[model samples]
Target chain A: MNGTFDPPATGKRVIPGTYVFDGDAARRGFAINEMCFSFNEDANRRAFAEDEEAYMERFHLSEEHKKAIRERDVIGMLNAGGNIYYLAKLAGILKLGVQDIGALQTGTTVDEFKAALLAHGAKLKELQTQGETA
Target chain B: MSTIAGGIFTSHVPGIGQAIAKGLKQDPYWKPFFDGWHTVHDWLKREKPDVLVCFYNDHGLNFFLDKLPTFAIGAADGYRHEDEGWGISGYKPYPGMPELSWHIIEQVVHDEFDPTMCQKMLVDHALAIPVEMAWPDEEESWPFKLVPIAINTVQYPLPSPKRCFEFGRSVGRALESWPGDEKIVVMGTGGLSHQLEGERAGHINIEYDTFCMDNLSRDPEALLQHSSLDIAELAGSQGVEILNWIAARGAMRGSVTELSRNYHIPISNTAAATMLLENHETVLA
Candidate 1:
């Protein structure tokens, strides 16, 4: 119960729609982030691609962290303390962009995620027109 | 004496850098965005400030989760373009001002805004992209001295929007009191909207972004009422980078005359924006 005071923001526990990569989350995801950070190097990216499990184990990530990596779970990794910036390196290994992570978290296809972004542009144009008229 | 000549606020989206790197500025997809900078390029050519104190957040170039500084200043003579996971090619090194960097570091610390000093740093797109956009003719090299300031907006426990404003004020004071005739420009880059990753992944709040830009030059203080969470929720997680814009506004001291402003959407997962503001005192009499 030591984590008692650390109540989640809402009844849903996780912050709705986002995972903030804060200090405590950084602490929790240290090993996982360290492994991901190493992917900055082409050699490190290649090493992980060659032998995923062995490469992950070298970082000594916890079972939960390892599982999240194994499953390619972006949100799970976030819950386990994976900062999205660092997790992006892992996402890179999987050829996934931030949109892919968004798609996975929101349960949408990549094309749909892209469509939503394009729609945002349409919405902006509409708002600009309204502003001009007003 | 050194003076805070003006402030330039813009979005330094990574894709903008890619477009420049790949020579795709003329492509229809990028033409509109690049067109926005045409005025900025002409403006920089005329202003040609001696030094530019560029403020931006690092994604994952120089600092990792191991040891991240809340506020860090680069005092090196130059910085090379970081690979940033994907390769970044053909970016010439940016010149730095070590003398002015040390003076501000000392003065701002005295002003109680303790920023970490990085003697060497590989600056990522957040700082590099805006410089490139403003000075599109890369063959001649960067004209102004750059003092790269990296704020920790990436991880949690980010400096409050209010605190960021205060920090910029301290830097402004430092620039003001410094013993030099150097013309200085403060640049705050990043954000309008568009979240990169999360359940609300392609989230773009034009209203919030518009509200921010419309009011930034007039009542930047009004924005403080909107907490970081309010910004993140209304804008996006990465949208919090607007704090740097608030800081840039603060560096201008009080009311500034806006010379130019532009806002465009979908510049690589963010709503891109630019504003050129001159200090009230420095404006034509």
Candidate 2:
């Protein structure tokens, strides 16, 4: 394998116009970014900690589902299919094994459990697919 | 039965393969690995794997730091290669298995795994450089068909390791269900730890890397059982990403039969390691 490069020409997507984020565009972009990446900030955590149900209302997920995940209830989150994928991230946080995150915990193989997961991730991807202007 | 050749799971530590080959062979911690893989190079000629499904991450070089896809599969008939500032001439335009790639993409997405399909993307040296050096092909055209599976690692908050591992299992299931009769090999490229950024650079834990290489090939489930935090503690912040290899292990039915594991450290910005495993019915060459 040497010097020649044959780049794939199809993956690049063309956009119409560019908008500066210094004005109204910036405000809108921040709002959207906040909406999607809301759970990580300290302020949001405190707010959600105070009124979990009300906070859940502001977002797309249900209060019960959000609570279950916040409490690290793995099975409840998985059964609910409500932001459970993120909870899988907690397996590492909790010192649980990687395979143990889902079916691998129950002594079943990964294949038996992944189809259901891909479907959930697929749905989530659709919800968050379109991003703002570059 | 198709014989299994070997699998590689290494950190794409920039100029690692070449740098290590240059001077690391003398370091006590590094010398054995160099010696071990010296044998693997010769074996590849004899074993000759027909296909390789490389799992690598684009270091903001291809897709950029702008938008990152959680899991992207190369489906184009050919890939656009990026020149890595380094003077190395890289691989020829890689031929993609569009029909099979798309078939798997559709099935996986249909089954609920959303894999971004790439037609035009830069094949960064973070991936191409080390991979080529590991098993250099001097005669021009590659000896085998290629299946490139890229994961987003550079950008913060990428797919969770659990998600990555499960993706590998899904990929394995996809391959198992593929009707084609060709022989195949799978590799998980990147990381054994040592953060490239922040103040925690140059960290190396021979024990942690050794444990990772051992468990990853034979009993990955056992390794994944530990929390990502545990892996991070053992490996380092970026090292926690080793679970990414679990994805490749997943395709091999969660059990690795044939193994080639290499570990080296402080190669540029990371502690690097590589593992090559074989799945059932596929021979490793």
Best by DockQ: 1
Worst 10 residues of 1 chain B by lDDT: B82-91
lDDT of each residue in A1-134, candidate 1, tens digit only: 00111222454334456777766677788999898888878888899999999998999999989887788777677778877777777887798766667778778887887787778777777877877511
Chain A TM-score values, per prediction: 0.84, 0.32
Candidate 2 off by > 4 Å: A1-134, B1-6, B17-33, B85-90, B226-233, B281-285
- Quote fnat for model 2: 0.00
For B1-285, candidate 2 gives per-residue lDDT tens digits of: 333344666666544445544665567544544554664576567667776777876643355323568788888776656433222334566666777677668767876888888876666655565456557555667666667788865433456666777788777667767777656667776677554211222334555665666677667766666655455556654565565576777667633564565544334435555555554554457
State each model's C-alpha RMSD to the native.
3.6, 18.9
Give Cα distance to truth, residue A44, candidate 2, Å: 39
Question: Residue B195 CA error for candidate 2 (Å)?
Answer: 1.3
Residue B188 of model 2, lDDT score: 75
After best superposition, candidate 2 residue B203: deviation in angstroms? 2.1
Best by TM-score: 1
| Docking model 2 quality class | incorrect
- Residue B255 CA displacement from its true place in model 1, Å: 4.2
